[model samples]
Target chain A: MIALLMRDLRLAMRAGGGFGLGLAFFLIVVTLVPFGVGPETGLLARIAPGILWLGALLACLLSLDRILALDWEDGSLDLLATSPLPLEGIVTMKALAHWITTGLPLVIASPLFAVLMSLPGAGYAPLVLSLLLGTPALSVIGTFGAALTVGIKRGGLLLSLLVLPLYVPTLIFGAEMARRGAEGADTTTPMLMLAGISAGVIALLPFASAAVLRVNLR
Target chain B: MELEVSELSVARGGIPVLEGLNFRLAAGHALILRGPNGIGKTTVLRTIAGLQPPLAGRISLDRETMTYAAHADGLKATLTVEENLSFWAAVFGTGGIDAALDGFALRDLRARPAGALSAGQKRRLGLARLLVTGRPVWVLDEPTVSLDVEAVAMFVRAVRAHLAGGGMALMATHIDLGLDEAAVLDVGPFRARAAQEDHFDEVFL
Candidate 1:
């Protein structure tokens, strides 16, 4: 399992761009938002929680296909399937790798993007916390989507379509938590909900991903 | 240990491709599957390797007892030759890649990324992965596609060494590998019946 995760990290790093490209896309999207939404600081701050949440979600989505598509293309997935490791282990390691590569960076960078939207000071911790919890769910769910469409050629658009609806719960709870935090309101409910969703997803979604990968390999 | 397949059936894209196939590969031996392109030789090898479920019958060998190498090399282009070997080595719970590196004569290219190697060199690296698997049964599909004469000799020698070390190999290839220890199984006769017969099976499913 560690070997698979290390290999994935090495591949992402060597593939050039790695998480940097995703971060750049997030930056561009957030930077463009204030321009498009008019330079009203109040309005920007008002929408900042959702914008940052959406930006982080999209950034994580950017590389979900790479989690499995590259392995599927090179036949590594087949070889891995035949190895002593179970497919569930492989899927878990893949999602973990995706989180470390894409989600971790997005979490770390959200505060920087938060400032761009003039988000209130109190929201920073909750924004970061919500994303830290929410992003793992995204990676896990996205792994299932990636596994589902791995065999189809140019399935990136399909991957996003499959994963977006699933992201709604995470995005809503995370953005709501951040929004309430920005407003100096209580954030306990949304925070717990986001954390619950992530916990449930982390514990179970890999099975679905592995099962789907089995069918794809078949 | 030996691999035994009896009355095994496999398919491609939901259509039965091969049926009632039977073959046994014992320790210290090799079996070569012979059939024309699209004759379902690959399907049989995959089924035996446990990559997919068979439609019927059984393979007596445990899946853990084997390693499979397909048409694709499964090499990471950005990883060095040594890095690539070690990755599989670790994944397969093997100790070192020195033997695989020596077996494929990849020492000279050890530091070079796999993407930098020529086609034949890449193919050699791909084939070398089998050495690190540490499994007795080698399930291979067209193991020598882009090899030159010398590389082909290297592969043949590798197979011989594997068999001598009490390993077994099952491969689907058209070449005359000149291995006297290997008995060939021609899959032409096992090809599934025409469309009409398959429709009956499909309806049953």
Candidate 2:
């Protein structure tokens, strides 16, 4: 499993364009929001957390179809299914790799990017922490969408459509807490719920992804 | 050692492709599955490999079950050829990496990504994965599909060698695999749910 994770991480990094594209997309969304909203400093600071959360969610969705789609296209997924390692383990490893490449970098870069919209200093830690806990769930849940769409030739738009609805609860909870923290309000309730969602996904999503992959591959 | 399939049936897109097929192979023997496209030769192999469940049947091998290799080759293209084999070898916990590589004659291409291999070479690489598995039963679909004449001969040699070493093979192929005493199971005329007594194992002649 360590080997599979290492392998996917290397692939994501070496792909040269996919990683940069995702990061750039995240940055562009964050950078472009201020322009649309008139560059008003007070308004920017007020909506900073929501903007970051929304941008992160969109950026994560942009890359979800690519997750299993490439592997399926090139026949690596078939090898994965036949490997003695259960499919669930393969899904987890792939999801972890996705998180490390796309989600972790977004979490790390959020604070720097947050400043683009005049995010206050008080909100930085919780914004980063909430993303840290929540993005893995995004990656995990996205695996199911990827699996279902693995056999579909033109599946990119369909994948976003399928996955976005499932992501609503995570988005609501994550953005709400980040919004509270940015406003200097108590955020314990929403943050805990956000963490719970991540935990539940981490526990259950791999098996579901594997089951779907089997059916699709069959 | 014997691998048995009893009353195996499968459907594709709601149509029955293979219905209640039964066959068995003992150690040191080979069964050539012959059928046309749209038939269920590949389906039988997949079902035995545990990838697809039989609609109604059981597959047991030498007091145990078996593993399968479908046409897809099941490789991670981003990884080096060696990494692909090593990952599976580690999973099966069988031969060491060095031995598996040497056995497949893949030492030179260890650093080459699987994506770089040609179709014939990819087929060999796929077969190499099965070799590294060290499993008792080999369920191969179109094992020689992408190979050249030389590679096909090499595959024949490998299977003959594997059988001599007590491993069992259930292979689906349209071409003759050059087995001296191998039995052929004509899955074409044979319906999916034939009785065990109805099975006839005839040499290729």
Candidate 3:
């Protein structure tokens, strides 16, 4: 499993692997928000949490296809399936690699993007915290979606359609948690809920992803 | 150990392609599959390799007992030839790749990225992967495609070495791999009838 994870990270770091693509997209989207909503700091501050969460979520989604598409195309997936490793472990490692390459960088960069949207000073901690907890769930769920659509030709649009609905619960809890922190309200409920969703999906989604991958390989 | 398949059936996209196929491959031996294009040769190899579920019958080997290679080469363009082999070696915990590199004549090109290699060179690298897998059985499909005479010779040598080492191989190819000891199984006799509706899911169409 570590070999797979290491290979993915190395591939991402290589040319045309799109390692930085998600981070760049996140930056562009967040930078454009202030321009679209005008210079009113209050409006920017109010919408900042949702916009940042959405931008990060979409950015994570942007690169999810890479999780398995290249491997599937080159038949690395078929070879991997026949290896001694279990498919469930393979999918989990893929999700872990995605979170490391895409989600972790987003979490680190969230505070800077948060500043661009004129977010409240109080919002920084909760926003970063919420993302650190919530974005992993996005990576995990996006992996399932990627696996489902791995065999389909030009399945990017369908992947987004399938995955966006699943993101709803995480988005609601995550953005609400950040919003509550911005408003200086209690964040315990949403924070715990967001963490719950992340843990839940991390625990159970790999089996589903592995199963779907088997059917596609079939 | 020996690999066995009895009354084996396989399908594609919910339609039966081959039925009543039977074959046995033992250690230190090889079996070559012969049939025309679209004759489900790939399907049979895939079924025996356990990539997909066989439609019916039984295959004696477990899924991990064999390693499969097909047209894709399963390579990453961005990684060097050595990096590629090392990655598989690590995945299978098969130890060093030096022998694979030497066997495929890839030692000199070890540092070159896989995408930089020519067609035959890339194919050589792909075949070298089989060496690192260290599995008991090798299931290959037209593995000699795109090779010049020399590369084909290299592949034939590798197969000879594999079988000599008590490993097994099941291949689908039209070319002569020149393995005199290997048995040939023609899939033409096992081709299913042309009704795409032989499967239970036909009713949904």
Highest lDDT model number = 3
Number of the candidate with higher lDDT, 1 or 2: 1
- The top-ranked prediction according to DockQ is 3
lDDT of 2 by residue, A126-218 (tens): 899889988988999898789879989979999989999999999999998888888889999998999999999999888888889899877
Which residue segments of model 3 deviate by more than 4 Å?
B194-205
Candidate 3's residue-wise lDDT over A175-207, tens digit each?
Answer: 999999999999999999999999999999999
| Model 2: CAPRI class | acceptable
lDDT of 2 by residue, B1-205 (tens): 7988888787655456677678889998999999877578877776676667778877775323355777778776667888888877776777677755655577899999887888877788888887777877788888888788887777777788788989888888888767767789888765544322333333332
Give candidates' CA RMSD values in order.
Answer: 2.8, 5.0, 2.6
The runs of at least 3 residues in candidate 1 whose Cα sits more than 4 Å from the true structure, single-residue gaps closed, are: B195-205
Model 3: per-residue Cα lDDT at residue A116: 94
What TM-score do all the candidates reach, one by one? 0.97, 0.90, 0.97
In model 1, which residue pairs have backbone atoms overlapping below 3 Å? none
- The local lDDT score (0 to 100) that residue A13 gets in candidate 2 is 69
* Each model's DockQ score: 0.78, 0.36, 0.80
B175-197, model 3: which lDDT tens digit per residue? 98777888998988888765444
Over A9-113, each residue of candidate 1 has an lDDT whose tens digit, in order, gives 888888662757678889999999998999899999999999999998898888888889888898888999999999999999999998998888889999999
lDDT of 3 at B84: 99
